[model samples]
Target: MRARAGGIAALVLGAVIWSAAPVSAAPAEGVQRTTIGAAERATALRFWTDARLRSARDLDAPPAASTPPAASAAGGRQAAPGTGEEVRVAPLPAPGAAAAAPALAASDPTPWTGGGLISTTAGKVFFQNAGGGTFACSATVANADNKSLVLTAGHCVVDAGTGEVYRNWVFIPGYANGDRPHGTFTASSLFHLDQYVATAGNANYDLAFARLAPLDGRSLGDTVGAQGIAFNAATGREVHSFGYGGSAAEGNGERLNHCSGVEYPDAGREGSTMWGIDCVQTGGSSGGAFLADFDAGSGGGYLVGDISVSAGSSEYHPVLGNEALDLYRQAGAA
Candidate 1:
């Protein structure tokens, strides 16, 4: 699925849910994880795609008294997207109101993994003139080379409304109470589905990857360590997904929540994911990094996906599919 460059894709109105995807597997270097049974592959992949999308890391502001016509009228429907193939969208939930998720654990406010949100869409829509129109969200630090890179939802940085990109776009890994442990960085380049850049309508297709250029002359990773990224793997495998969102499980406003379990697939090509655990949450929690923290006994986390679409007790993430990895490799990140 390609972002429509300053345009949003056709939306099919319904309940809001969540999402991410990656393709191409580098040779499995770490301990090889077992794959899910082939019999369950079709079923698992089915629901993974058709999940609704929402924002992450912020409190669910009061529901809009009225939804905009453009947001309410999801009239676009096109052919299915490709996976492990060309860029394509998968079948997932419709975007919009679903239900207030159950309470979650209040997460740690201090960022242990050095991650934060990528966009401020939550700030843009819910609060006008807030943060100087500069919004705050969350994301996590990851390293492929010796550079500092972050993983987040596509819409966080890419403003579908204006072709112009984020102005104060910067990263503060290990942020706590506005405390930047790694310092600030302007995004050098952001990578997402061509679908997202083209259309703001596809939240399920929402995802953003980037290379950070330091603003304070402090290089990333040099300032703060980076999390390992897991590629070359299969679904239904056990992993951990952590983020700083509001909840009992995580905490409110500056907190972190980590959930772990096996991953399942979705229906459409976007290649959706259903977390094995339950973390009831609301808006302001999108773009959270999903890490598969299987330490070779080190007890650290390896990032695999980002929070894109979610709803109810369920959260939809984009598993690091094979196709997405190809994009990273093409960009020289992987």
Candidate 2:
């Protein structure tokens, strides 16, 4: 589904151009938070009130023995319960899973096998349009209120250098260097977290979600549709990936799509957002959406995860979990 109010595609576009230079900390003409979540809302008077707030270290850990068993990525690969292995964010999508599949009447697109690569999202906190600059990145149309929503890394939206956010941001789908086929959408909202925004030393969970206004004359999901979001599951038999690497190999256009070999699970990559699977990509590929689809079958593609903030390797994710879901939900709510 396309972002209802102009969602993920815009985020992917912004991230591609982000980090060119630092954006200002201060909000522009309409960058401030006109709306905030329950947590941020309650902070209005809490700072001056009598009770003190707790820091990250102050929170107690859930009892190790009381935690539920975590499913593994491997169909049969087993680990003892509560073993330090990292668990996936949520249960895999199926009829029983809370996650729902997209009503795709169209045959899915095959794994990108073209000569060039597809774009993905790579965000920078202080992104700006100082040079009329445009960045091309990949994004999936995911179901959110039956509308489109873009997903990317938190640092892409929030300023990494300072806690400042970007302003006058827009998403240019299929924006290759300067080739903008889908045109652009003004960003209405950017969703992230205080932890990533601060770039804390041990920050691991670095997901982000953003919203954008609809295109001038068309609707998103109605026109472009969207991919299904996968959660926790052991059913990943094989997956396909895409990206627009700045290498001479990717050629010079956005329409050209380059793809990777079949993806296999890397045990060490578990839990870290920067997880990597062997793939042929480099710097410009960060934030590209990792899609799930059948390369040789009738129904071909759906976006289940995204390329996390790592270079030279692949770390994609299907959006899920309580904490992460809450954060993303709050992003749309805000």
Model 2 lDDT-worst window of ten: 54-63
Give the alpha carbon lDDT tens digit for every residue of 183-244 in model 1. 44555555555544344435544555655665456556555545566654445666555555
Q: Would you list the C-alpha lDDT of every candidate in the order shown?
A: 0.42, 0.37
Name model 1 segments beyond 4 Å from true.
1-132, 161-164, 215-218, 247-250, 266-277, 296-299, 330-334
Model 2 ranges off by over 4 Å: 1-136, 198-203, 252-256, 261-275, 294-302, 311-319, 331-334
TM-score of each candidate structure, all chains considered together: 0.57, 0.54
Ten residues in a row with the worst lDDT in model 1?
119-128
